[model samples]
Target chain A: MKATHIQLAHGNGGRLMRELLETLVFPALGCREAFTDASPLASDKRIPLMASDSFTVQPLEFPGGNIGSLAVHGTLNDLAVSGAEPAALTLNLIIEEGFALDTLRRLLESAGAAARAAGVPIIGGDTKVVPRGQGSGLVIASTGLGWRDAGCALDIRSVQPGDAVLVSGPLGDHGASVLMAREAFGLSSGLQSDASCVLELAHAVRDLPGLRFMRDPTRGGLASVLHEILQASGCGCELNEAVIPLRPEVSGVCQLLGFNPLQLACEGRIVAIVAVESANEVLARWQALPEGQSATRIGHLTVDRRVILRTPLGGQRYLDELAEDPLPRIC
Target chain B: MKATHIQLAHGNGGRLMRELLETLVFPALGCREAFTDASPLASDKRIPLMASDSFTVQPLEFPGGNIGSLAVHGTLNDLAVSGAEPAALTLNLIIEEGFALDTLRRLLESAGAAARAAGVPIIGGDTKVVPRGQGSGLVIASTGLGWRDAGCALDIRSVQPGDAVLVSGPLGDHGASVLMAREAFGLSSGLQSDASCVLELAHAVRDLPGLRFMRDPTRGGLASVLHEILQASGCGCELNEAVIPLRPEVSGVCQLLGFNPLQLACEGRIVAIVAVESANEVLARWQALPEGQSATRIGHLTVDRRVILRTPLGGQRYLDELAEDPLPRIC
Candidate 1:
């Protein structure tokens, strides 16, 4: 008989755990052979880049994606934005006892597919089961190993006073999509989370000689990324609010819930800094990708160390660092 | 006012999260500079090894070590046993909302100390917070990156019928200590978890000409490791029960609780297989280390496909794969 749900024994590192991994995990994740404690990685000549992230989104299954695919993309994007080509990924799963085995299978398969799509292999991983009630269904922590391009030099210190600020696409779609999935406010929208790998968008701009740095606007959205730039580069940003791309559905949710669209998350977007001379080229390359159809230059770095937004009505307002929790587990 | 417990806003990746990381995490973990999402690793000429594990032990703190230290040792040991020198580590923390801030600080500091002791730097990491009542206070996942020794060629397939099996130290101290810490059975003992880095022990014998393989007996302990060898090498094991290292305190706990000492966990022990000609040198080298004072040859590989234990009374019994979990979250 097959176990319908996870058991404590399944994490005991005994027969049951072996059975669970061999029958479900290995097959779902496309593991070709039984893994030892640690696996050896192929040698790479280029400098190595490593990034790790833990995914704890509520309602494990959200619109457009689940925690599985989100985990892969989140970690991969960190490397992607750092001007590195992802080499491999390691997954760590913390499962709650009594969680449905079928659900676990689906998530693993989804993660496998996402990795395959991105051309990275899931080389090694570990799993543990906590007693029921001590955990929320599951949490996945993924670490990505990548190889940086030999000639690429990207850093926040390179940002200058007149550098342009650009975004790969519309912001806040992911935050809005997850909010509607919760159904806490009885709101509905056709919005889907823009949770995806930003590898292509990053690769497109990585070779640009004038590129300063690129960051994925995730948890705290565009506002957070802007604040980070102010702190790291000693350069503030002046945004043209009218030109910043945003979806109508995402803006509607923010208006109704008293949330700032700029403070909402967008998993599939990139905030990049580049010299004014090369800004148009960066925009052109990004716009060529389907994921970046809405790419736009929304702002520019300023001499003053304060993030200021110019409203369409010619009103100027300072954008402070995000100070409150708009949504928990938005990632 | 200082917050005494974690809040959802601390994970929002905004002001609160930045403060939490800067004021607590960075200083405690010896991070000299603010970290970007992904950190570049120095290139290593040798083959790289990767391993990952999640620690979900109950009680958070045990008799001899806390989850933080355990997390470091567990992942590093995996790499060490694979004949790799630890290079770097990545930490992932999943904190429950309302978890005590002081506790978090202590764990991070302990983890930092452990990493420092092992001479491994934490290059990158991530943190996420879950809603209250949805997590068991804290769970830590660690991933280790290592460089394999150039001449080391360790694999289970290297074992043959004449290979001798040796254990570095007594078994079950970790399991017994954690079990007693729970106080579920109102039992007490002086047992302390033997949790520490096994790098020196592994290094001492990793280059032995006849060394077949090495494994750290963790979750399913000695019995499970032997079973794995049997399955992978297509060779069984013949163990002499009288010579196996068993601490009196651990044996007492197992006897009173109807547990099998051979099947309980040990955090800092190694089980090695070597050609009979090299077994004495391996045991001698290991016994010189404080962590391996009780090192002894316990068994030898057999032609038959069965794990047979020779009893002190001249009777023999088959050691079957562990089916039931004696204790959950023992690691």
Candidate 2:
């Protein structure tokens, strides 16, 4: 029996999952080569960063993107956020048996296109065929390697209070997209999941020595990332409610689902803590790109480690440490 | 409820898994420092290499070294085999809910002491509390990183037709010991798993330039490794059954279990592919070490990619691929 939605069958390494990846994920991820454990033994310094992560989202496919594109974007974002010049990545797929092949192919194609546009290669990866009713549809672990020189060292400690906080694009796009894609509460949204590669922005200003730190807001949304920086650098942040970017549809969907837009995850967005001297230039550069056109200055770091969010009516409140597993397995 | 053996409950990331690590794994590995995220950002010109893996043998604790020792040795071997100077490791525990905390502590103590004796520090790691009955009693992922020079690289392709093979010690000790421990096929011999860190021997000779290739006989066993090398280097292997080290009990256990000792996974042994001229010197070095007292020269390489086994009765037979998980997750 085909999995109606998220279930143990999706994650298991079986025929069901194979059909899912073959039909959904492999297509979205755009895997050109057949899956094999014996990948080509070659890596260049341009793609010196090799990172692997496994995704188990609550809902299989979400709005603006499914688990397929999310996996690709997640891996790409890791490379981009790290300041490395991403070259290529290896994808390992573990799927529950009986997943539809069409679904898997569509997802893989989407991911492949995304990767191609990002100018990164998906050279090699492995796909495990699991049993039915084991996994939901798929659980992907992609390991990416990118190249970076000593000059790319991002200092978390460099996040200074008063230094402007900027997100590459709108917040809550991916998060709201997930809720809408799930079709929960009989609701849907036109908002797109902000899942794309930041390679263009990264290379556009590879010479930007002032870019102190950059991180992708995936699980736990923009709030979680900012919180991490605050704790790491012993700093605080206060957002200007009016300036924070949010899609109209995202806001609507969040309201319908009783979810916090600030807490939703994003795949394509980048949160950069830069030196005050060049924040505007970085923002301008980001805004010039298609993926970064919606970039906005969300807030400013403070001397304290507390996080504060200002309401539309000028009310200020603290954003506490994120409750774990936000949107449970939204990665 | 003690879960002396692993159950689906161990992987739940709960109390039971904790006890296994705290009592069984940690103490066995001998880790000193509290686990953390990153292995202390490597110092100097050290090119850090980290490897993480999970072992789920049928039985909880095996003969010579249980899950605890294998976790440490496996990671250490990964770095060692890669020619990286041993430094430290971090232990990540994913245990089920009902596991005994006492067992967890005991494991941690053993892991700690082992790390100390091996001259490596146990840095910080992660512990996830999973839901009940979802996972096995314990699933451990140990990440180890060490320093290797820029020019230091071990290429499997470096193997020549005349290259010699050096077995660190006996081949089937670990596999046989696990079977004995697990009572696989209704049999048990008082055999102990040869699970120990190859660092002492690895450190004693990693600086030597002629070591062409290295691999820990895990998962797939000695034959698989030979097959891998042959395929990669376009070479073949000639094994003299008499020359290859095999414990009497290991042979007995394999014969009874309808298994081949060559295909069984091993934990402690290091299979070094080296030049014929340097093979003697390398074996001498291994023999001098306490862990390598039984070290021996096993065989030599050939141009063909096929593996040929010569039996004790002077009959020649081809060693084929293994079709089953002989010893499920022996690490």
Candidate 3:
């Protein structure tokens, strides 16, 4: 009889572990190499870039994506935003013993599909199982290797006064959707998480000569990314609140929950800084893509080192870095 | 006034997370980059090699090392045994909310020390916090990028019948020592884990003209590595029980627990297959290193596809791939 749940033996690095990898892991990840210590990465001439992230989203599976897809997108997005084309990825799964095998398979398949869609292969991986109660159902850590395009330079230091700020899509959907899924507040929403690869959004503006920097607003959302920009460039940001895209469902939940949408996570959104001269071109390119249909120019860099939001009422408010934990394990 | 334990806020990608990284993680890991989405890998001409591993060792701290050091050694050793020179590493830390910050500091410092000792830089990383009870103290997933040696052509396909099998040091110390630390069975011992980088041993034999393959006998110990070799090369291993190196403490623990030392884990050891003519040369080189003083020729590859163990009494028994879990999270 096949075990329906993971056992301690499945991580013993013996027959069961081998069987698990060969039967489920390898096939799901599209890996052809038999178990080996390490894999040889294809040699490339472009400068190499690297990024890593860990996904601990609660409930494992959310509306539009699960921890597996989030893990892939999260790491790959980091590389993408850095103006690099992802070349390969390495995954590490820490599974809790007694977790359902069916669920594990589903997550692995999602991860594989995400990687395939991104055109990046997961070439190496490791699996370890913890005692049942010692771990959440599962946590995936991913590392991405990419090749930086020649002649492209993206750095926070490049941001100067008057640089424009743009976002790829709606904010707070991921965080709000996850919170809704948890049902801690007895609220339900039709909103789906925006967890997805932002590679296309990145590629759309990567060649813009006036592009200064790009970042994916994740855990701490757009507000946090703006704070990073302020710290890095010694410049302030002035945002038009009415222009920042936010879904009605997300805003409704945030208002009820007293959470700031700007401070909430957006797994699939990109916040970019471009010179005023090239902002329209960047916006046009992004708005043409399905992932960036709602892309908008939200604000611009200021000489002063403060993040300010121009409300619809014509009042200005300082946007501070997030301090409290609004929701845990949203991504 | 200060929280001595980790909080969910520390992983929120906000002020708390920034302070945590600046005050604890960055300094401990010798990271200087202020939080960027990704890092740039130094361009190199050598072929890149990638490997990843997660460490969930129980007790968090064991006799010779903690999870932090173990994570570094485990991932680096994977690359080393694959004939790659250590280069850079990425770390993903998943801390249980309420875990002691002091303990986390010690582990991070140990990880930094290990990387420094191995001359590898941890260039990129991420941190996530899980709800307290949903996690063991902490789990570290590390991915390593390395440069393969210029002329090294190591692969299992090169292994042939009559090849000499060698081990760099005693087996099961890591697993037994961790078991002792757990004190789950009220048993104690002075055994210390042999968890360290095997790069020196790998480098010593990598240039040999007849070297067929090299592997780190880690999670499944020497026996499992032999099984992998058997499966990959269509060859079997014939080991002389008396000739294999074993520590008295480890053997004592295994005997008391009815565990096969051969099936236990070794955090830092090498199992290599070399041409019979070059075995003595490889042994000499390994024995010269302090880490490999106990290096021994434990076995030879056999044409018959059956792993056999020759006992001191001139009788033999088949050493099957491990089927049961003797311990969990030893690595």
TM-score of each: 0.98, 0.76, 0.98
Candidate 1 residue lDDT tens string, A37-117: 887777768887778899998888888898999999999999999999998889999999999999999999988888999
Between the candidate structures 2 and 3, which one is better when assessed by lDDT? Answer: 3
Candidate number of the best DockQ? 3
For residues B150-173, write the lDDT of model 3, one tens digit per residue.
677899889999999999999989
- lDDT of model 1 at residue A275? 97
> What value does the lDDT take at residue A21 in candidate 1?
87
Q: Alpha-carbon interface RMSD of model 2?
A: 8.0
Local error of candidate 1 at residue A14 (angstroms): 0.6
lDDT per residue (tens digit) for residues A125-228 in model 2: 54443334323455555555555665565767777888888888888787676666655567644677776666677665556777888877765677767766
Q: Considering DockQ, where higher is better, how would the candidates rank from best to worst?
A: 3, 1, 2
Model 2, TM vs. native: 0.76
Ranking by lDDT: 1, 3, 2
List CA RMSD, all candidates.
1.2, 6.8, 1.2
Better of 1 and 2 by lDDT: 1
